[model samples]
Target: MINAFGALRPDQPIHVFTKASRWLLDRTITVPVTIVEQAVDSGAIQRDSLQLDVPATLASAAQFEAGADEAAVALAREFRARHVQVAVCDAPPMPCTAAHLAGVPAVVLANFTWDWIFEDFIAEHPAFAELPARLGVRYARADAAWRLPMHGGFGTVRTVLDFPWIARRSRRGRAELRRLIGAGDARPLVLISFGGYGVANMALAHHAGAPYRLVLSGGAEHSPTDAPPDALHLDRERLDALGLRYEDLVAAVDVVASKPGYGIVSECVANGAALLYTDRGRFREYPVMVDEMPQVLPCRHIANASLASDRWDEEVAGLLAQPRPEIRPLVNGADVAAGMISAML
Candidate 1:
């Protein structure tokens, strides 16, 4: 999983880039990590076979150029000097450089939950188009590029790997919530956030008679300040791939109304829930950027708010009225990923 929100600085609170990257790393096999984020250098950490985070002893902080090629090269050299094998890297700051310089292949991919139902969106994105030369420098797998036409430009397909499917961990904090409206009767529950923009969506939730849960993830720059009902509190936990936050909720919620950011949508699709979006546009936090964005969600691409759009609300209501669908294990992007990584190694 490669995170970019720390670089793009989106308006919402969620860190899509880091979330996606960690999710992939979680489902896959053991791979040492040296995270190079803009303005910070998180020391190296060892991973487990199941990709779970065990206690990691940190080294002295090293200098890394923010989003610079030199930083990547420096890290690679450090790895070589220490005789350490660098398995994977997140976007920018040298995963590509490490692959190019070290002769290891880089599998560039967006996290699974983010890209699920949006019309093979990888082809519509910019990173896929821009990273090829860097990729071709040695061996590389543009993870979802071939499947998602939006991620690439006109080019021949190379390796195909599935990035990990990261479900949300919203349910963990559910018990902590106090109570906003003391049971406003019965209404649909919607989770809303413009991804670290700090937009307070309680009004929308209130209007729709739905309770919304806001997730403040990662070490974001500006945390969400506005408050919703105490019943709806903050969930500030780091959820790796094994977490069942999304799996549990998707099995329970009416509709997953969110901005068409990749991870959330992918989770909705895998969970078998209908999706509704307030609108559509560019999200710097989005790991994969696509031009023909509408095609991203083959299931539902909503322009107006679910509360505002009659057809969308009708659709949502229809979904809620039916018996809840059983949530099942979704696509194993990491296994596809493991195959790609193994081929490269």
Candidate 2:
């Protein structure tokens, strides 16, 4: 969403609505944002109190639905007062319903919708059975939906438009960032990205003698107590101090070792970096990305067992050995989406 915001016309007015607890909002976004109280919180994978329990979230569905109802009323009131012409969101159900309630046209931007994701969990936990259909009904209210690359099926949306990758480009050069991280040596720099909700019990220390130098974000809970000399754990403060953003480090690296998520995949494609991915649980979006991402960039999958055991040398070599795609997909979906939104206005 930030990428699309940056791509919009300088004179265009925009407002962002997100959850209050979203960590990325603080780290990446600069625009004034409105916190939506009833917003569905992201699931965390760490072994901490903050970890999002799927069963718990499903059990509280009624509470979330009631919150969404209140949020829609408030948002609709605000939209009418402001005379807002169009509403844009990243596949949130409340925003779509709110826009509909305000009699405003809504444009949904996403690779996958919450409805599709929730359906995957219904078999394991029956509490999620109704969520998919309910969310789908709301999502279908959108004026249009922009489907990005490595996308999943959007069965509920009425009008779906395909778009290229929307990604953040690296402002700093590779050599400059490598120097900043003290990775001057010829060894490959592998960025371990598991998103803000980090993985627990990751054996990062076991890769001490690997051919690559590992770089982990400080936000990740997967860091071992006894880290190797080759590993570099950088927090947001360190990144800011070194005059770099997370995307800059991603662009600088030879390969990003991660579970296939939209953010990391798009960034890798935009910056011409290889991907060494692993399974990210039962989320339906994982298979879609793993299958489709390789056609755009060099991508190789490592098993979850291999990742946990730090047996990544083979996968890393395979990913590096693969040649990049000759005809790369355009990374200008943000610009294209901005134009589409402008046209609506």
| TM-score, one value per model | 0.50, 0.89
Which residue runs does candidate 2 get wrong by more than 4 Å?
A: 1-7, 20-23, 30-53, 60-62, 199-201, 219-222
lDDT per residue, candidate 1, 59-90, as tens digits? Answer: 11112322435656765565466443323433
Quality of model 2 by C-alpha lDDT: 0.76
Worst 10 residues of 1 by lDDT: 49-58
lDDT of each: 0.38, 0.76
Top model by TM-score, which number? 2
Q: Model 2 reaches what TM-score against the true structure? A: 0.89
**TM-score of decoy 1:** 0.50
RMSD of 1: 12.4
lDDT of 2 at 321: 95
Q: For residues 1-345, could you state the per-residue lDDT of candidate 2 as single tens digits? A: 554654565455556665555766666766554544445323323323123356665656545665776778888888897777888878777778889999999878888887777777798898567777877888888988899987775788899999989998887888888889878788998887776545455555377788988887765465544557778877777888887888888888999988788988999999988998876666678788877887899999777777666567888898899988889999998788877777887
